[model samples]
Target: MDNKAIATDVLAAVGGKENVTYVTHCVTRLRFNLKDSGLADRDVIEKIPGVIGVQEAGGQYQVIIGTNVGQVYDEVCRVGGFAHETAVMPDKDSVGKKSILSSMLGTIIGCIMPLIPILIGTGLGKCILMIIQLAGIASSDTSMAFYVFSFVFDAGFTFLPVFTAIAAAKHFGSNQLMAALMGCALLHPNWTSLVSAADPKFIGDMFGIPLYGMSYASSLIPAILIVWVMSKLEGFLNAKLPELVRGMLTPLITLLIMTPLSFLLLAPAMGYLAVALGDALLTIYNAGGGVVIALICFVYPWMVVTGTHSTLAIAGMQLMAQTGYDPFSRTLPLVANMSQGAAALACALRTKNKKFRSTCLSTAFTVFFAGVSEPVIYGVTLRLKRPMWAVMIGSAAGGLVAGIFALKAYTWMTPSVINVAMWIGGDGLNNLFVAIAAMVVSAIVSFIATLLIGFEDPTSDEVEEGADYQL
Candidate 1:
C-alpha cells in the first residue's frame, strides 16, 4: 500500500485523529502522543501494510515504519490536519500519566531528535575534510579549506544553545520565538565576552544578588532547562496577567525573569551536573576501561528494545560536549550496530528459504547503512533467537577491544558503518585503527557465532511478509 493509505489505516486504528494529541518521527518510527493509548488497537495497527511493528514506550504509541517513516509522517500530518514541522500542545491527561523517566525520555528525544541531521552532516563533513587534507589536496590543517569547514561545522556546536532552546520550546508547547530568545539570551555577546575574560568567574551583582558567570556556547542542558522554565513561566503569566498586557508583557517578563535566573541558578547547576556526569563516566572508564564498554555493548540491544538507549546516547553527547572526549557512547554503539547487521548477514547466508534470506539481507542493509536496528532486532534476531545472542556476544567482544584502546570520540556521532570516520583522529591514527578492528571483530564474531549457534531456519511455509520482525 501507499504511504497515505498506510497512514490513514494506522491513524484510524489508533483511535483516529481525535485520539492523537501530538505526533513526531525519529529515523524509523512514527511516535504518537495519544490522549489514550488504550484507544488504539495495536494488533490492527501492526496488521496495516507498511507498518513494521508497534511499540508503546516513553508515552508514545510508536509505529515502526523503517526507512520510509518520513514520507508516512508527512502523510499523517496531511491527513490528520496536524501542522507540519510543529508540535501541538500535548494531551494533559496523557502527560500526567507518564513515569518521570518516560517524560524525561520524551523531552530529550523531542529536543535532540531534531538536531541529529545537523550533527550527522557536521561529522561527515569533517570526515571528508580529513580525507582531503590527508591526500595533500588541502596542503595542511591550517589551509583555507580547513578554515571554511571549521566554521561551517563549528556553527552547529557554537550556536547549539539557540537550536536546543527552540527544539525544547517546540517539545514543551511553548513559543518558538520566545524559546529562541532564551537560547540567544544564553549565548548573548555580553555573556560570551564576560566568560572569555581573565577572571571570568563572577559578574558582580544584580539587585545586590551575586551573579555568577558561565559560558553557554555549545551548550545543551542549560538551554533545555531555561526553555522548560520559559514554558511554565510563559504559561503562568499568560493566564494570570490581564489580557491587554498578556502577549507583550508575558514574553518581556519571561525573558526578564528567566535570563538572570538561568545565570544565577539554572545554567550553573546544569553545568555542575554535566561536569559530574562526565567525571563519573571518566572514573568508571578508568576503573574497568574495555570491560565497561563490553558490558555496555552487551546490554545495549536490550536498551534499544526498551527504548532506554536514548538516555545513554544523550549522555554520550553531553560527555563529548563537556570533556571533548567520549570513551564509549560513540564507540560501543558503532560496534553494536555492526554486530546486528553482521548477525543478520549470518542468518541471510545460512537460510535457504528465499523470503527469509531476502528479509535478512534487507534488514542487515538497513541497520548497517541506515543506522536503525529495530528492523534487525525484531525482524531477524528475535525471530531466530540465537542471532540475538550472537549480536550481544559480537558487540561485547568488539567492546572489549574498544576499551583496551580507550578510544575517544569528539563529536555527537551516531552508530553506523558510514560514521566510522567520525571516530577517526579521535586520539590519533591508533584510534582509527581501533575503530576498524572493533567493527571487524564485531562482524566476524557475530557472523561466526550465528552460524555456530545455528538458529532454526524458517521453512518455506513459516515465512511471510513482515513475518520476521512484525510481531
Candidate 2:
C-alpha cells in the first residue's frame, strides 16, 4: 500500500480519532489502545506493505512494521491524531498463546517493560538517596527519608506481579483487572510468605490431579498464562450462562475452572518447563561462553530488527532469578546496546536526512546514557546494512571478551552504559569495570566500522515496508 493509503486505512481501522485511546511504538510495532479492538480491521492492516504482523499484547493492538517502525508510528499518530501519551487499559482477550521462543521473549519483555519506567525513576531516586545518605542528610540505618527512598526503589521489584499482570493481560488479550486479580492470588500477603518458604515437595491436588511444586516470587510465566486462560474461561462463561446469573456465574465459573486447572495442572507444568529450559540454556551458555556471545552478537541486532530480542532477555532473567546468574549472563547485552548506540551516532553524523539524523542522535544518546536501545536499533542502526554489520562485529568481539572475563550482573536493569552498577554484586569493581571497558570498546569499534563502510537511507519503497509497524 502507498503511504497515504496505508495511513488512511490504518486510521479507519482503529476507528477514527474518537476511538483511539493511546498510541505508542516498540522496536517494530505500532502499539495502540483503542476504545474497541473490534473496531480494528486486522486483516487489511496486516496486508499493508510495511506490515509484518498484527498482535494485541500488553493491552494494546500492535501493528508490526519491522525496522522502519518509528516512521510508521509517526504516520499512525499523524493520521489518527493520537496524543503522545494516553492511559488506555488493554483488553485482556488480546493475548495469544505463543511458542517457546515467543513465550521467552514475551516473558522477558513482560518483566522488564512494566518495570522500566520505575527502574529509571528508582535509579535516579537511588542515586539521590545514596548521595543524601552519604552526605549525612539521611541516615541509612534508621531514618524516614531512607525508608521513603527504599519504598520507591523496591516497589517495582516487590510488587512486580501487579505490573506483570497489566502487561501480560494486554499481551494475552485478557482483561487487565481480571488478570491483575489473578496475579493478586500469587501476590497476596499470606500466600506470598507461604510460597516463599521452602516447604518439602508435596503432590498437592485439586480434583485428584497432582499439582507441580514451585514458588511464585519473581515469576512471570505461570501467572501470565493463568490469567490468559482465566480470561478465556470468563468469556466462555459469559456467553453460556443466563443473563441474571452471568455476573456472578462468569466469575465463579472462571475461578472454579481456572484456579484448579491452573494450580493443579498448568502452573506446575509451566513452572517446571521454565526452570528446565532456563537451566538447559545456561548449560549451553556456560559451555561455549565466547561462541555463544558471538552468536548473540550476530543475531541480537537482527532480532531487534524483527522485534524479537526480548525473548533472549526474558530467558536470561528467568534463568538468572533461578540460578542467581543466567548462563547468558554478563556484558553481552550491554555490548549490543552500546554497539547500536555507536552505530546510531555514526548514522547521525553521516546521514543527511534530517528526520533520520535527528532520530539517530536522540536514540544514540538515550541508549547509551539511559540504557534504552529499541529506539537506536529500530530508528537507526538496523536501517543501514554496513552500520548494522559493524554493530554485529563489535558485539561479537565485545561479547567474546566479556565471556572470557566471566562477567556477571546482579540486578536486572536495562542494558546500558549506566547499568554498570548491576555488575557490582560480589567482588569490588572488577566486573563493573570490565563491562564498562567492553561496552566502550564495542561502541568505538562499531563507530569506526560504520564510518568506514557507510550505509543507505530507506528508499521510498522501503518506507511502505514498515507501514504496519512490523519491524
Candidate 3:
C-alpha cells in the first residue's frame, strides 16, 4: 500500500509533526495524542492510502489501518520525526480536564488492548483442546495432550498481572522491568503462603499494622496501581537522586515501597472490585436474562468503536472461571460480529459504487472469518449509518435467541464463524446448535434490515471508505 507515501500523506493531513504530542499503535489502529485534536482533519487522513478509517475517542486521534498498522506506525514516526513509544501520555495540563469516564476508558484501553492477542490465543488453545476431549480422542484427565493444555490457558491468566503490569508501565512511562518485578512480587511464594492460610487477616503484622492477603495471580487492578505509583516514585527518585546512584536505588526503592503497600493497601482495599465487577455482571445477567444478553450484544459494537469492549472480553473469563461456563460475554460477540458482517454484505450488494462495494465485501469477509469488526464498522456501517442500526438490531435478535437457548461459550476466543468450536460447552452440542442458529439469525436479520433501511449510496467512483464522528 506504499506505506512510505501513506505515512508522508498522513503526516501532512494531521497538521504535520508539530501538532503531534504522542503516538502509538494497537493491533489495528495508529493512536495519536494530538497537541490540539481539532487541528487534525479526519476526512483528509482517511483518504490516505493504506488507511482503513479514523476515530477520535478515548482522548486520542486514532487512524485505523488494519493488521499492518505497526508498519504504518513506524513509517509515521519516521516521516513525522516522532519518537517511537516515547511517553504516549497526553500533556499533564490537559489530563485533568478529562471527565472521569473518559479517563477510565482511556486507561483501560491503553493498558488492556495490548494484551488482546495473548487472551485470544490462550482461549482458542483451550477450545481446541476441549474439542479433542469431546471427540473421545483424549482423556482430559490422563492424556499427554490434555496435561500439556490443562495449564496453558491458566498460565496466561495466572501471570496476567505480569503482562498487564508491563503494558501499564509502558503506557504510564515507567520502567517495564520494575513493573515485571512488582508483578512477580505480588505472586511471590511467601505471599502465596500467607494467602493460603486459613485466616488471612491479621496473620502478620507490619509495624503493628495488620496484614491481610489474597492471591494476586489472575488479578488485574493491583498490578496497574503498583506500576503507576512506581512510575511517580521512580520519577521522583530520578529527579532527586544523584545520577550515579539513581539507577541502582530507583527500582530498588520503588519496589520496596510499592510491593508491601500494594499487598497491605491496594490489594486489600481495592482488589475485590474486580471480583465485584464480575459478580455485578452476573447479577445483572440473571435479573435481565435474555434481555440483558441482548443488551450486551447490542451495545458491544459501540463499545468496540470506543475500544471499551476489551474489558468485557476479559470479564467473560472471570465469568467462566466462576461458573465453569460463560453464558453472557463470549456468546453474543459472535452474534454481533456476524451481524456486522451481514450489514456490510448487504451494503456491498446495495451500493452502486464498485470500489465501496468491494470495500464492503472485504470487510464483511474479515468479520466473518478473522472476527475483526473494525473494518466494517468504521469503513462501512457507521459511514452508511442505517446499516449500523441494522447490525445492532440483528445482534439483539440473535442475542435473545442465544440467551433463550442458554447458549454458553466454553472458551475465550473472539466470537466469529471460524471459532464456533468455542461453543462446545457444558451443554455439549446443544450450545453448539444454539450458536449456529444465533449466527444465522443475526446475519439474516442484519442483511434484511440493511436492505430495508437503505443508506445514501456513495455517488463518487473514488469512494474512499469511513466516518469518524457520526452516523
- Who wins the TM-score comparison? 1
| Model 3, residue 103: C-alpha shift (Å) | 2.1
Sort by lDDT, best first. 1, 3, 2
Model 2 lDDT per residue over 1-471, tens place: 355555666777777666665566654466665666788887877666545556665445676655466666677767766533323333445334334554444444543454455545664565456546646777657797789777767665556566676766665445677777777776677655555564524545547765555666566677767866776676677788999988777777777777778767777777788888887886787798777777777677666555556566667667766765543734556888888888888877887666666667777887787665655665566655578889998888788777777777666666666556666545666777777777877888888888988888765455444333222
Higher-lDDT candidate of 2 and 3: 3
Q: Please report the TM-score between candidate 2 and the true structure.
A: 0.72
Residues 366-430, model 3: lDDT tens digits: 88988878878877888777788999999999999998877888776778888888888674588
Model 1, which residues run further than 4 Å from truth?
139-145, 198-201, 467-471
**Who wins the lDDT comparison?**
1
Greater TM-score among 2 and 3 belongs to: 3
The TM-scores, one per candidate, come to 0.94, 0.72, 0.89
- In terms of lDDT, the poorest run of 10 residues in model 3 is 462-471
TM-score of 3: 0.89
Which parts of model 2 are misplaced by more than 4 Å? 1-29, 32-140, 171-175, 193-200, 203-208, 324-330, 344-363, 372-380, 454-471
